[model samples]
Target chain A: MKDPRLLAVCCPDWPVVAACTATGTALHVPVAVVDGNEIVSTSAVARKEGIRRAMRRRAAEAMCPELVTFEHDPQRDARFFEPVAEAVEELAPGIEVVHPGLVAVPARGPVGYFGSAEQAAERIVDHIATHTGTEAQVGAADSLFAATKAAHRNMIVPPGRTPEFLRPLGVHELDAPELVDLLRRLGLKTLGAFADVPENAVATRFGGPATRQHRLARGVPERPLDKRRPAPELAVTETFDEPVERVDAAAFAAKLLSERLHENLAARSLACTRLGIHARTENDEELQRVWRAAEPLTPRGIADRVRWQLDGWLTRERLTSGIRTLTLEPVEVVDGTALQLGLWGHDDERAVRALLHVQGLLGPDGVLTPVIDGGRGPREQVRLVPWGDERTPTRNPDHPWPGRLTRAPATLADDPAALEDENGREVGVTGRLELTAQPKKLTIRGRTREVTAWAGPWPVDERWWAPDRHRAARVQVQADDQAFLLIRRDQRWFLEGVYD
Target chain B: MSRSATASLSELGVNPASELTSTTTDHATGRVLPVRGELAGLLPWGGLRRGSTVSVGGSTSLLLALLAGATADGCWAAVVGLPQLGVLAAAELGVAVQRLALVPRPGSDPGPVIAALLDGIDLVAVACPLPPSLARRLTARARQRKAVLIAFGAWPSPDVELTAESVSWNALDDGAETLRRQQIAVRSGGRGSAGRAKNVLLTFGEEEIELPLVAGGPDRSDEPADAGPDRADELAARRATTREQPA
Candidate 1:
């Protein structure tokens, strides 16, 4: 394939900058985004204060006492950077976003139309700066790697001079620390020195990745651009005469808007899987966010997403203005055939609405949904968590619970019953894991039942290593018409549950 | 020409207007859902009637057994206030796990919970004892909503009441501690001429508790029985296992 000149537009310290901009933090403040304990990205002010990328958070803070830290959020960066990408897309129709802060585009068409590669780069930089209010650097070269390096210093290399432009750059510019360190040990300090090594020698020494970069340093691109087809604009928008300041009002409005949007999609038998929500405030501020789900959206699902987004924006984002207009867009859609309907004669559509209404009245956690999990104990087997809040259970069911009952009892008694033998004396289990007496009769709620047949003194010893150790013996007794599973813990007997 | 054509259609005892609206009304509100073997014979209509409350008086096993057939046939069942329900046991009894919802501990007043479930769920099995007024309210709501309700214990009023009169546990005879199978004699009585006592002998095998059609006789082979549903379940199980395997 023919190699076309490509231009890369890059914004520095994008994650920290996006976080600061979203929170309205001043640019002059030193800021860094920390992943675990290391700084991933740092603002210009933080960098100037010797707080660099990958620096330990404690070390960075010590260097700059006033350093502000933000948790690294990829979603926040991508969501906030969408406007910048759109601004560049307006000037150069198709730009590939390699990540949050960087975008690359084929310069052949735009450069020829604008008369010069320099003019095309300037146009992109100007549009992004004017529209997104973010400073950007643009560089043009034959390969993405060389173009990215050129963009770091905002230079447009002339055709066939990419290798010459990259020659004086240090090996560190290759962006592979291990390869760079290896090259440095081999006495190769510059890109020109590394490229001078035989291609076969480099392949035998450093393998595939190093060879690909070696090709880039020699002005040859690894491959052509994977051209992207621009997504269609299938967004539904609505404007309110009055601005919505309250979250509940916004949620209600969002629900209605979702219904309107889904009705349009339903006619075409299409359902959106990935959705983008865009909001415009009274002060002319624009906010955009995207939500993705494993399953395609129903009208109710769309409404839940809109409400969740609104809740986060209003409560956590601390926006300066109220929303005046809102738009719901489908970023990706699939045929409705994958959508499953409720079973025969079941009206789940209405049930979901009723449950959601209940959830709203009661707190979100007031209503719960149940899921079956593998476990030994009666209470441990089924997990119940508030609807929409699915979490892993505290107990791991995969482990072998050695002393659990082999057969699950049919019913769990509301409360444990007291047991006694025919002598009208209480039955008990001793420390030796032996029954004190042969269990005979069972009494529950004042009713005494005669036990005709009885089974085990099956002992269970649990958590012997912990402070709270438990020792119990279980027995199966057939009394009157009902068969009961009784447990003796410590010295007393309590009816654990009933067997149906 | 159109008027003569319409007139001819109406004259043939086929009202053109009724034909257009007939499809909507054909969804019978009182239609009975087909159930498994002897349990079918126990009911007056040979199946579970919609908009009715049936009492499963004795065993929770009976409730799970009753749900197995309906849930296997793609009906959704909601179990409320029965926290100790052995859902794994229900799965072994052939109930579709995907179609089951458990609200084991429906706090304080379970009436609203059952009423809400009745609006959509085909069958609701409630285990808690209901006060007379709340029971009346739920029964009326169930009938109006056209959802079948199954109460685990004794209830105030029921269209059909199934009670396990006798339960005999099968032992190894050598006095080994393991208990194998259980045979329950369930008697159904309640409501209109349906009060005629009906008895069913259900045998619990390794996998399922089935009502043998001939009381104490050998198995019959006429009915395709569970083959169709079993194949569907196999396909679903195969799909699930394949998905769990790493690529």
Candidate 2:
């Protein structure tokens, strides 16, 4: 990695300037791209004008009456720079992208091949212009910072001329803005003036990091050449002309997406486990569902989960109305090895399919898996939820979880029932009825029972601070034949759950 | 494709009474029975089958209470479109509302919607305002599919063998609100066309009554003109407020 260098081609108004650039036509950044102090655009001409980006729109318009404003498009910008990255990759396989429009390619082999460093840079810039009809600028230095600075400023300081080239630049180039301003206040502006100052004086003011920078200003780059790595894997999508209401239809579309994803992954021979399904509703509610398969998922599995999650909204649940778009993003991929299928089949995926089928039949909570959390209270410790929906775990597992119950009740009380008194007459039930004390007998369905053993009138006072969601207490009791978990708050006895 | 499942469903014919009952996994052993009806002979099988749709006429509460008895031993049950029913009360009555899903039928796709819903979940009881064709289809499907199909009205279909009707014994028309809110009545009759089972009078919520089979009378007469569909409506209205009986 000898004399490795970095190259950055800034397209200040790439989206605004890319239609012609994509096909190799336009190259210059638009005038008035920047509105003020800010680099509102990559336009070289815009930088010369006082107009900067994001300054008062009126202010920008006043400076340049015919200035064109273009909406930013990441896709177009990426497409515009693809040839540039490819051109660099052609020179050397080792390349890294800092951004869609900025890339760094190693200059060692290419420089050596083209005779000398200057000749190599000139030939490469010529190649870039021929391939991508844009004025190509090349900068060569021992370090990426120096190379980037040279290209950004459009200077071609020859190989061994770095120290002399940096001598006249201001000290602020080395990131000592405060010190540079202080020196300028005292009427010292250039790097040569700073180099003339005692090294001890500079060290005493700016500390250790400043001393490191002092050496770099003498044209010595400290950054090491990095081994080339492939660009990050990303999934892309397109919207539909019409809304889709069926789950299978979404899966069908996602299958098409899977092909695109496979193409991207196969290019690098990689796979991922985590997938993201993004659905944009007609009402503009951006709903995102993430698929986290325990193992690598086939396109079908991805599609099924995507469809079911879409089922959670599009078909199964009522959407606001129409759908605007859909997106399937395999956000995270895993390093997967080729599987050697030992037999005609593997583990049964059919069981899970059947289980999901039955659950759909038996309402939501028909089939449940028992989940145990770190809670002392029986009810809080164990939760029996349908299948998915792991969102509402028993909270406060670490605290002395109260009450004595088994799994969380399969059903929640939609409306508070009228608790009956001893005579089976309706009584008042304003809040959660928790029996602070053990009831002597629990009569259910006109059948009276005895309370054999009991745990607590554990005051489960959750969200006492939140006025809307104030739950009180639940006391667990064991009878001769049955075990009941009783809940109470404002002095009443009603069973909330069972132990079986 | 394997043809076993469909054949098995056909082998197990439908029973009327158990159409809306859910099976409970016995607490002691986890043993599960497909149906549990205390009075099985009242329906064809003495058990309600899964996937069947049944309709019972008159009040919605009767169907709920009947289902409550079938599910009391820990079975699961579901009731669709009992619009006035309080689900929590059903849960407490031991009818596993957690195992239940109440579908809202605000419009009239009453037949198809109900059938499609039954296709997914076990149809315990569907409280619907069904027409004759829908009622007939539900009855026929319940028998073949081994599911219990019940309609809300006593509009009998040839598919039904036994029917329980709860009626208010003495609810006379008055210009005012209920003069009396006591004394419920019930009557049980089977195979009006076949003419076998008798009316079992039950003074509900009081002392029980016995069965006295009487045909060729106004209530169960062969002649449709004596009391047609309009009479059925009048009978239904009278049964709503007054106490009920079984024949």
- Please compute DockQ, using alpha carbons, for every candidate against the native two-chain complex: 0.08, 0.01
- Model 2 DockQ class: incorrect
Candidate 2 Cα outliers beyond 4 Å, as residue runs: A1-290, A294-325, A329-500, B1-38, B49-54, B58-61, B65-78, B106-108, B154-186, B192-247
lDDT of 2 by residue, B32-91 (tens): 223322223233323443433333444433455456544454343445455444432233
Number of the top candidate by DockQ?
1
Could you give the C-alpha RMSD of every candidate to the true structure, in order shown? 19.5, 26.9
TM-score of 1: 0.49
- lDDT leader: 1
Candidate 1, residues A135-247, lDDT tens digits: the string is: 89999898878888899889999988999998999988876678899999999999999889888788667764576567767767643233222146457899988888787
Task: List the candidates' TM-scores in order.
Answer: 0.49, 0.30
- lDDT of residue B54 for candidate 1: 94
Cα error of candidate 2 at position A348, Å: 17
Judging by TM-score against the true structure, name the best candidate. 1
